[model samples]
Target: MDKSHQTKAFRRERVRVGVVGVGGFGRSHLGAVESLASAGRAHLVAVADPFREQHVELDSRLSAQGVAWHSTLEEMLEKETLDAITIATPVPLHFGMTRRAVEKGVFVYLEKPPVPLLSQLDEMIAWDEDFRVAVGFQLIYSEPIRFLKQAILDGKLGTVRSIRGGAAAPRRQSYYNRASWAGRMSINGEPVFDGPMTNALAHVLQNILFLGGGDAWSFARPTSLRGELYRCYPVESFDTSCVRGVLDTGVEFAFAGSHAVRDESPHTLEVVGTRGTLRLTGGTFSSDIPGLELPQHAGSDVPMLASVSRFMDYVCGQPETDIIRLEDTRGFVETTNGTLVSSRGIFPLDARFVESYQVEGDPGLDVLGLGDLITQTITTGRLFSENSAPWANRTPTVTREEIQSAVLEEWIFGAEENPKNATACL
Candidate 1:
């Protein structure tokens, strides 16, 4: 009985689900689970979080739901016989937690970035033949985005020439202070790999990839990339990133993101093609081509809920549909990991370019010329290095082969590859 060929028996009754990690973004996963419960598509049988008692409000809310809780995941798993589980744990915990659930034959809805390292992702994908695992890239599940995808496939926008996407959101020091591992590249010598592009503004990056074609593996893979990573805040990882590359399909892709900028620009993904252009800004989609009519959808489900519901549908024997399986995100994992591997060293801005300010009575950091840089890269489809940003390095390049080599050596041969020294071999 090969594990790849093994399939979990479909549960005909209401699928019983559980969630792990109920803090930070976990609350969003819970809200989506509650939506599933309300719709009678699934039942949340239990929850697990070691720090639940510290947050009295969250504790009270879970109590109100009348579901059982445990201080640890082991306890919850022992008590509840769940058909599926949604993992909202930290990036460091994702691989192990999801692996345990999958080995136990439980279906999983895992949080984004799937896993921090490429080797970990490869292992998970190898065993996910039955498609029991769904990675939570919520925007891909949005009805509007899906419609736009089909429009592109239908040639409504013609051949995509280039893509510009990013988000300009600011985070105060308190955000990094929320957890011991917050904004850290590594915790206790293991990869947490949390940063602006990989975590916070990940949706923007993935949207650009998805818009290119198929899933992350087939459609969105970049042939080559140049990235400028900068840190305005005191963290091991960069908070501001600008990346530009050409996908294997030859479509140009550019992404700019920051947690240091002010609210000067709306988050957006604009696709430019030979025939027309399509833009998604602030959750609404519009295009320059006239007479583009989107079919009306049943009111939108909170992206997380929509994803959870679809996973539940699969568990209940619903015929296979176009859900975002874990393997579909290989291209995304490669891109993010490549960005981080290339962005290994912390290039802090000069004191003159950094501005200290009070954001909601909390300390914040902003770079003087970041906004213009963001806009310029998006407009011209150029990497920061090409645009001659003063802070950018001399021709910083990140290749897929380099990343794959480092990750393989680290994860397989047990060699400690220095992620920060990505240019050492070069």
Candidate 2:
């Protein structure tokens, strides 16, 4: 084929794409698809959201581009013949939406923490026989993370020893009030398990497991986990957590996170090896390795955009890249589930240890000395209980098998009543 023919063939390989959900993080997905569409790499065929009419400007703008809007994913799928669809719905709706797309033989770019429960994730994995679904752990697509993973694999970090990561970002009362399911263990009989370790700061936890894996493209499965779950805010689920565990490869890992802190700290990870240590904060990395550097992307540095582009390339018949798949997230699901079981249940922190403050006209809580506690945990690879937090509970360790067989209702409303139904106290 001549050069002109090759160029024509490339232009004809655009993937037809649709997006589900358009609020909050869903807007980011819409923007990514639009950007790809502008580059002639994809066609933004349609979007579906229950509240599609709420965003008047967005609806008009997308409609002007010949994009269709629907009140449900079923309608969108029935009318549009899409090569791929991005599912950005709520935690509970992910499985049903993905199952619909899968039934139609459409590829999917599922949002992070794909499903709240391991069993639901397992069902998705079973349905995805053709390996067409890509879980959106955007950081795994970043150049810095990719470089760091490769460095660990190439022995640049020496023998991997331990991994620790944490983030302290305060969430106002309005944050949890924005949705019915926010900060809840379960909503209407479906597992949401919304919390720092599973929802907001989950990327850091997932990345820790990803780097701890034996190979470049796998996540280390957790064999056992010990954790403490606490809530300073009036939410059914925890706003703060500290979990430590051993991976299948025997590497020890620790993570701490909170939505009850006074100030925000950048999400950071530390990988300590025999010869040197590596640190990643946000998009940048600093290490003890001589002259080590991160690669640059030709397009945007945003991880979400990079992830969307990679998935679109795969849909367009490019060779399969090492993008995250459904099977790769088993370790993450196991760790999340295990943390809940290990803690027995989310403990409400003593009111005396929590102080209320207003941030930007929104009511918020600051757990006394929580910033230092998080720092201590991440630095020493210790749980809050080990660090001697006065209010911290020493919970027993739980195995992955126990987590898999555990019942959700037992965790939420076992012998103890739902903490949210009572006063906030230890």
Name the best candidate (by TM-score).
2
Q: Tens-digit lDDT track for model 2 on 44-149?
A: 9999998966899998998898999999999999999898899888887888889999888888999988998888988988877777788999988777677778
Query: Candidate 2: where is the Cα deviation over 4 Å?
Result: 1-12, 289-300, 412-417, 421-426
lDDT of 2: 0.83
| lDDT accuracy of residue 235 in candidate 2 | 83
The Cα RMSD of model 2 versus the native structure comes to: 4.7
> lDDT of all the models against the reference?
0.74, 0.83
Q: Tell me the tens digit of each residue's lDDT in model 1 across 372-415.
A: 77777777777665777776664456777876765422321221
Please give the distance, in angstroms, between residue 162's alpha carbon in candidate 2 and its true position after superposition.
Answer: 0.3
RMSD of each: 4.9, 4.7
Worst 10 residues of 1 by lDDT: 417-426
Clashes of each: 0, 0
